[model samples]
Target: MDERIGLRERKKQRTREAISNAAISLFFDNGFDQVSITQIAAAAEVSRRTLFAYFPAKEDLVLHRIADHETESGRVLRERPGAPLATLRAHFLDGLERRDPITGLNDAPEVLALYRLIMDTPTLAASLLRYRENGKQALEEALRDKENLPQLTARLAAAQIMSVQWALSEDNYWRIAGGTSADDAYPAARAAAEQGFDQLAGGLGGFL
Candidate 1:
């Protein structure tokens, strides 16, 4: 039974990757707004229904990874061993220190190209906005366990934290897009993340 589940998961992952690869190729070639899921499915050699199963909407094909980050803030808050704010602050800082791909700390040529693609495309920008909104919601959920932080308060706090991260990501993307190397971007990202986290830690006392 475990073997069967593993096989199924692998197959699902392969399909998703194929779809994403096809979408990116088409997007880079002809632009994101001009591409359709049906065309992507055709390129991927998958049926339209299969494409929908993997990605319900066209944006999901390009922004599939965005969903994972949405759940991460909540996970960090809930599973953090020490102070939540400190944990979050340090977590982001560590990602900066490590030049994590998800944090946009790196300025690899491919990363820059992808970032440029997202920026040049209106659909992608809208998708990114939705992605950030989802991240804020997830952070709010994580803050729910903290005492004295009412729902609105928790949400506002989450918004502030996620907003900072969002801004940092955009800045890093543009810096890389503007010709900065990963080596040069990492220090800037680290410093910016540290500052942002420090501010959140200072102001969000009751929540974290």
Candidate 2:
């Protein structure tokens, strides 16, 4: 029974991936606005109903790639040992070393293409802002629950951490987008993350 359930889950994941890949390919070739639900559904060989079952909105077809990462900071804080800020700093640095897309240190062609697509589309950009805001709220809850911080303190810390992280990611993305290789940018990216976290530690010294 468990084996059957696992197989069923894997099949669902494959279907989802096929639809996402087809949609992204179409969006990359013809602009995001030019792609339609019916077209993507046809390309993926899935019914429009199946596509909607997996992804509710047109924007989700693209944004789903990043949805899993929205609560990463919260998870890191809850799961990792040691100071919250230090754990987050270490995680960000590790992501840079791994060329993780969430850190914006990835230089792969597909990653860069997706970044360009998001930056070029105002609607996608707006959706990303909302996603970031949601991430901030999740982190705040983690701080309040895990660290036993006051509500206001948790809120402030989460905002500062999220802002610093976003700035670091944007800087890394632009550096790679503007011609710098991820390898070449690694040293500076590491330094910036260290400094950003250091500043955070100082500012939130009492709470963190």
Candidate 3:
């Protein structure tokens, strides 16, 4: 049973990677909007039906990772045993420290190019906005256990958290776009993220 499950998981992971890589290659080669689901499946050497099983739409081929991040926020919050704000603050700060590529603070040229591709594509940009909204909603649900908060407070807090994270990500991206090396971008992004988090901490008692 264990072996079977492991194999299944590995297969899924490989397929996911294949789909993502294929979609990115195509998106960078042609354009995000120019690519179609059938073309992505062909590139990945998978049937269109199989691709849909992993990703319901063509956008998922590029946006699956974002969806994962959205889902992960809720997981992190749920697993946190301490103060919610401190928990999230530390979580994101750790992500910054690790120079996680998703943090957008890294100077990977390819990554920057990917960002530019997303920016240049209307469909990708729209998908990104939807992903952000989904992330906010996920966080709100995760934060629902907080006490002394009125209804809608969870969503309000989630909005604030998303705003800070979004700002930090954009700052990190801009730092790289300004021609800073990855190493140089790291500290600057970290410091900026820290400063932003500090403001949130002051306002929300370390939750920001």
Candidate 4:
């Protein structure tokens, strides 16, 4: 039964991946606004009903990738043994070195295009904001659980951490999109990241 469940989950994951790849390719080819759910379904070789079952809307087709990241910070906090803030700081630094898109450090053409697409598209931007909020809540809960802190303290810490993280990424993304090479962008990005994390560590005390 466990094996059967694993296979079913894998199949669902494959379908979601196929659909997301098709949708992103179409979105990048044409504009996000120009792509239709039916077109995405056709590109992915799935029925409209099936596509909708996986993704609720056109915006979700793109932003689900971002939305899916809502748990990542919490996971990092929970899985690592050291201080949560230190762990998170190291995670972002690693992401920067690896050119992870979440760090906005990748200057690849597709990555640049995605940044432009999200900035230019209102629906995607709105959806992304929702995901960011969800991320904050997830982090807050994790902090509360791991620290046995007050709810208000967790909320405040989460807000600060999420804000700094977002600011760091936005700064890097704009620099990269504006023709700064990733290597050239690294110094400023690293500076911003350090400053952001330092601020987070300093402002949110008692938890690490």
Highest lDDT model number: 2
Model 1 accuracy (lDDT, Cα): 0.79
Tens-digit lDDT string for candidate 4 (1-208): 9999999999999999999999999989999989889899999999999999999878888887766577789878988888888899999999899988988888889878878889898888888888888888989999999988799988988888888898889889988888899999998898889888887778775666
Residues 1-208 of candidate 2 have per-residue lDDT tens digits of 9999999999999999999999999999999999899999999999999999999999999999999999899988999898889889889999999999999899999999999999899989999998899999999999998999999999999999999999999999999999999999999999999999999999998888
Which pairs of residues collide in candidate 3? 85-207
For candidate 3, give the lDDT: 0.79
lDDT of 2 at 87: 88
lDDT by residue (1-208, candidate 1, tens digit) is 9999999999999988988898888988898888887899899999999989888888787777556776687788787777778878788777777777667777766666667777788888788888878778877877777544689988888889888887887787777767787788787778888788878778887557
Give the candidate order by descending TM-score: 2, 4, 1, 3
Question: How do the predictions measure up, each by TM-score?
Answer: 0.91, 0.97, 0.86, 0.91
lDDT of 1 at 65: 53
Model 1 root-mean-square deviation: 1.8
Residue pairs with clashing backbones, model 4? none
Q: Clashing pairs in model 1? A: none
Kindly indicate the candidate among 2 and 3 with the higher TM-score: 2
Q: Which 10 consecutive residues of model 4 have the lowest summed lDDT?
A: 199-208
Worst 10-residue lDDT window, candidate 1: 107-116
lDDT of 3 by residue, 5-84 (tens): 99999999999899889989998999887888889989999998998898887777777755667666667888877777
Candidate 2 segments exceeding 4 Å error: none
Reference-based lDDT, residue 14, model 4: 100
Could you give the candidate ranking by lDDT, starting with the highest?
2, 4, 1, 3
